[model samples]
Target: MTWTLKLVNRQPMKEKLGLLVQHALKSGVAAGHLRPTEIPLSIALETPRIAAHGDYSTNVAMTMAATQKRAPREVARIIIDHIDDSGHLLSKTEVAGPGFINFFITQEKWYEVLKTIHDEYEAYGACQIGLGKRVQIEFVSANPTGPLHVGHGRCAAVGDTLAAILEAAGYQVEKEYYVNDSGRQIHTLGRSVFLRCRQILGDAIEFPADFYQGDYIEDLARLLVDREGAHLPDMDEEEAVGICARFAAEEILSGIRKDLEAFGVSFDRWFSEQALYDSEAVRSVIQDLKSRDIIYEHEGALWFRTQDFGDEKDRVVVRANGQTTYFASDIAYHKDKFERKFDRIIDIWGADHHGYIPRVSASIQAMGYDEKQCRIILVQLVNLLRGGSPVAMSTRAGEFVTLRQVVDEVGRDAARFLFLLRHYDSPLDFDLELAKKESNENPVYYVQYVHARISNIIKKAEERGYKHMCWHDDFTDLIKLPEEIQLIKLMARYPEVVAQSALLMEPHRIPFYLKELAAAFHAYYHDRNKHMVVSDDAGLSAARLFLVSAIRIIISTGLTLMGVSAPETM
Candidate 1:
């Protein structure tokens, strides 16, 4: 059954952490006391809406008390008593706040966490959960009818980063872009371009009012003129429409590639929708549906009885003119994806397509696949902002801001970071001016600046000639500070954060983790020069060096997961 598992096994990491907690609880139970999972080890690793919880806190004991038919405080005591005292950074452990277990870690642990950081600098927080399972992520599949706007950019960033995160966690990943070039839209684009070309050639032409109007149209028209110049004879409606469609499709696809490249989005596949047509997959699908009685004649057109499979209304597969609808090709395309033997099919669609979920899922189900295997994410629109005011962009008016414009205006790093900083479910307001700012007022800059600053500090330390000293040696004895210990525990949680982000399909979690990690690093660095860790005092220096190393590695790991560069020196 396992020719080779090509998907990630993410449960192991969760099991490992859970088992550690379980071991502590088991030890408490052997003592004949009410042992529960609620004893919080030092430095609460919790999601805090209120900042004063001291990192992570656990109420597992309280919850278990009701089930075990025992008192909450009694169970909490059982957990606290058996916790391994070997936790060096743990300073004070207490059962508090309604049977919750809280532990304070020593600051020296933070320094040691730095050492752990340096020890695994190349692979800090990396996990083997994926086990090299193959995963394909398809995103930013905007129709090549127009330039990519901020809306498309979000899908690009999120899809790319999700792939990166999964890859970092040990998955074999592929990033793909699905091109909608074989649809009615492409024909419209061609008809539009052909008329523009004929007009440019001084030929009498009636332009279609529904054709795309953009300055880029002139460029495409000129390109056609460049390629066909003298050979271009007078074209009739049929000849002009076909020529225009092919030319516009090629040019627009090229533009899409260039724009995505400008924003650092690379795809392993630019699958053609027309491929479905060329391969006769659409015809085959229609025939198959007809054989299954899923197809019926309606008003001289062929309609798919999608309603039988849960669609709100029956969908027309073929018009009276015998032309295929976009949905017909889409069904074939998704069926094609499934036939590719991909264990999972992920599509990052625009929010406007939310209503299509039911039909798409139903089709996949009807095609003999689990509906769950076809996952669609609808990312809300990104409202571009400048100086706290919304910047409305309309492609119909040819006033849209391209992905290139955003990347060029703010640099690729900031653009990608800010786009993914907010939960994809929420509305993200991307401020061009704020992103372009050179100061730390921007969250991206603040996070990146911390990495750069750490690099500088490490460089300065090496310049002072303490490069060979054991970074974590002195930190062992120094791992007694509360702030330092808190940071170390945070370092240990990076893998957890990454695993959660991957599971939730939320890339924003990575950025949020980086912010919190940066805050910890900044807190440690702010007054360290005044209360310096004498780098030459071998023990103290090594300890502090370890802390520095941890920060560097964690930053590198976080940045890597986000698909951003973590420079040694910013």
Candidate 2:
């Protein structure tokens, strides 16, 4: 399973067709049919939005018309005249509208996808487009303050699924969780816990309103009291708070790890902010930036000239009090990431951090690395709903619905699926009642049912003593119904969909494709006349069975990419 072999086995239809269009342009140029001095470096082929337009439409002719000194349609006609269809790839080629070249692939050529799917099975849509580039994706790096809420859950799902997609597209990926363990928040958490411990010890201390009010803090305090009750009565307040902070941070982080594991998210590394300071990396980065003149003193503060590299203004790396800002640590963290030699660094942050992109990009650029190498994905907030009404959540007050609660209530499959129902940048409204439903209204159930239905069909066929038939040369001819053709076409587009999704760094496309595929299968299944997988006609039955088996494989693959389950039953 060399990368080259994988690519050869799954070269997408779009790529193959694009090559033909490229050849056509070259032929026209060489034969002097067009007046361009040289052909363009690449030809762009896109699927026509309207099915009636054609399977694929390219506007290369329009792009070349000026240089060719001819009307767009005339250049298109000349390109069509020179196209070599020796492979029988296109059944019809039309020059339509101003200059677009529309290609209708032959039915037989489309059927070849069925054999490819049969041969490839689980690896049908996998591609080597990434060529094993090393990519580090840092995500769900939620501060170790409290239990993860639904918003964190959504970020987890998006990052995990995006990693899966990049892997399928042949990129070596590492998932990371950045633990912000050293900050004011951790001290606040410790103080909160220490106050709770005093209350547990019957002290009449007033709890501050600004401290963490989550019930989890009280729970941590109780645990701490049970572990060190005898010494707490005599311990110094600052010393006890430090101990409590360390204890609470470690406990909360442990719970965070467990919840992510239960949610099917795992990290290759748990990077600590304190470690950067301990190793002097943060201070070292500031000095390096100062030597490069990227950092300067301004009004008694150390400022980084971020505005010089596209930021709205210079940013303070260290305040007048001489404490380093979070931005300083971030610069050091990203500098370390670049030094690690990953081909790409991806950070998934909450949408509220959208304004922070430019400064981070500036930091990367200031560090002498291309800012493009660092990609940031912003995940929007998730609004949890019960029966369409909003579920209130206050993180500091600790009334929020934890990711654990959602998973426990609706199961991991539904939770992950619903979290990824929309793009990461768009706010998601996750309805608890809708997600738990067992009917088609539940998108996960709808997609998973396609796999289950096909599984049952195959099982029933086997029980009826129908011997399993491998894909045959004539199977395509037998599968000529409009519905069957449509399914094969959709399946043929799977490889392209995956490659495009990876290229665009979008994982939502996978679910969108799966839903479309499931709908097509459901429509075909409900029409009883064409729905039988095992019938008197052995050839047709075998072809239909193979068609559905391919469908099952795709459904399973898509769900697996989303970190969802494709259950055999319900």
Candidate 3:
């Protein structure tokens, strides 16, 4: 169970391949096999699906074929001739399928991958490809009218995981939550609570069709009455509504924070929309736009020249009645983000906000900022189900299943893992029954079981008198089992998977990788007689134990990045 293995200093296999390819190409030029020119800037290396082909394959020869005025196969042959297998990184090089160079790595080199996994453990899949750039990820900016629903759960999972992956990739990342506390919805919430308060005081009043109709509003009203007492009924109606608005907003927002915290999502900052208006930042942004001739008065309203900047039509920043639009405050908020010097800003929004991207991007350009600096990731809907039937949800009527409720039902780990099982853009059907099941069909359990199974194996090994020090000892040559080799190959891909996920800002890849790793471990485990961990052969036993120990570390690492727990006993 000890994961604190000593560090093993080694270059990444992929980097070694790139270096080897470059050296061969240079040798080709030196021998006059090809024309002398600058080497290609990047050499792409990929794992072939068929293991017999090789450990890695590249099309660099095909790329050089046209430039060298020779067949791709001819180019591949010249490059292969110069490749040195003395380093034992590559056992042999093959020219396959129209000059695709395939590299068969030595088994000893693959053993080093397990050593790297053991050495890194928690930092196993981490990389520095981000180059320490600062990134801001804002998600689940739902209005603080009520508790977060299941859809917000999906956003929370994606955003939190993306931040973790980016940080793991050596980027300075900050998770943010935008609080929309200054909009028409806030006023409507105030009205809803005021009506509930009137009813609490035994007044006869009809509830408006447009007002919020949730029980939380009544709870806020009750809280207001408990604090203010009989004096509230005698106060001016508008004055009562104003006090109620601030009170209800704070209460609702407090609930939101609690729910997010329970779901394991926390933000570095809670930015308020009202702060923009209170500090006159919205007006300042509009003035800056006007100074740049990006705004003009049309129909007695200040209009942003959005149409000129690729919007379908001009957008009104300030209405004729002097009320600034929501779009105006958003522009100000994004401007504030840029002024704060974030190298990259990513917004995770609901799929319904797809149309909002163009106008926001246009506004960013109109204000003399690069539109590419801001990227919006639209998370599609989450369909909650029970026994193959859809669960009802409606944000407008406040009848949706709250994130807290979902977590309470199946626990936080299942909720997070299920939310991240698919790409953010694809709609997810979350079957409640399936998530709660304790069988292999349940993906969360299947992956977590792998970690627990490895722990049990190591525990059995110790119980059978095998010293824990055996894992730290050298046992590379003894680990040549077929299943063991396949397991090593899959585990070797973890660092690349993490780098790709971070580069693409996609957290779904982590869950996919974990599932694949779990399958490999399960396959290896099923052959108990062949790959026994506590065999009489000390060298083979130590090697199998070491392999399983590495698997345990990787499973824990992958689960941790996705904000899910890797249970030692599931």
Please, what is the TM-score per model? 0.87, 0.95, 0.96
lDDT of each: 0.75, 0.89, 0.88
Q: What's the alpha carbon RMSD for model 3?
A: 2.9
Largest lDDT belongs to which candidate?
2
lDDT of 2 by residue, 1-570 (tens): 698755553567787788888888888878877675778776888878898889889999898888888899999999899889887889999999989999999988777788778778788788898999999999999999899989899999999999999999999999999999987789999999989998988989898889999899999999999998657757888998899999999999999999999999999999999999999999999998999889998889999999999999999999998988889899989999999999998999999899999899999998899888889999998888999999988875778899999999999999999888898878999999999999878988899999899888888888877676587878867888877888888998998888888988888999999999999999999887757778888888888888888999899988999999888876
Cα-based lDDT at residue 122, candidate 1: 63
lDDT by residue (tens digit), candidate 1, 1-570: 342321112222233334445666777666756534344443223533443554445677777788667888777777677678563535666777788776554444445335444555666566677787777788998888878888899989999889888876777887889888876888888877777887888878776557788778778888888888834546567777788788888878898899888777899998888888999999999899889878888899998777877889988889999988888888898898888877667889888888887777767777777878777988988899998998877777677888888888888889899889988888888999999888878888788888888778777777877676454343466655657666776776777788777777789989998899998878787876633544556566656666656767777778777667777665
* 43-138 per-residue lDDT for model 3 (tens digits): 889999998789899999998888899999999999999886557788878999989999988888788888888767799889888899999999
By summed lDDT, the worst window of 10 consecutive residues in model 1 runs over 4-13
**Which 10-residue window in model 3 sums to the lowest lDDT?**
1-10
In candidate 2 the C-alpha lDDT for residue 555 amounts to 93
Ranking by lDDT: 2, 3, 1
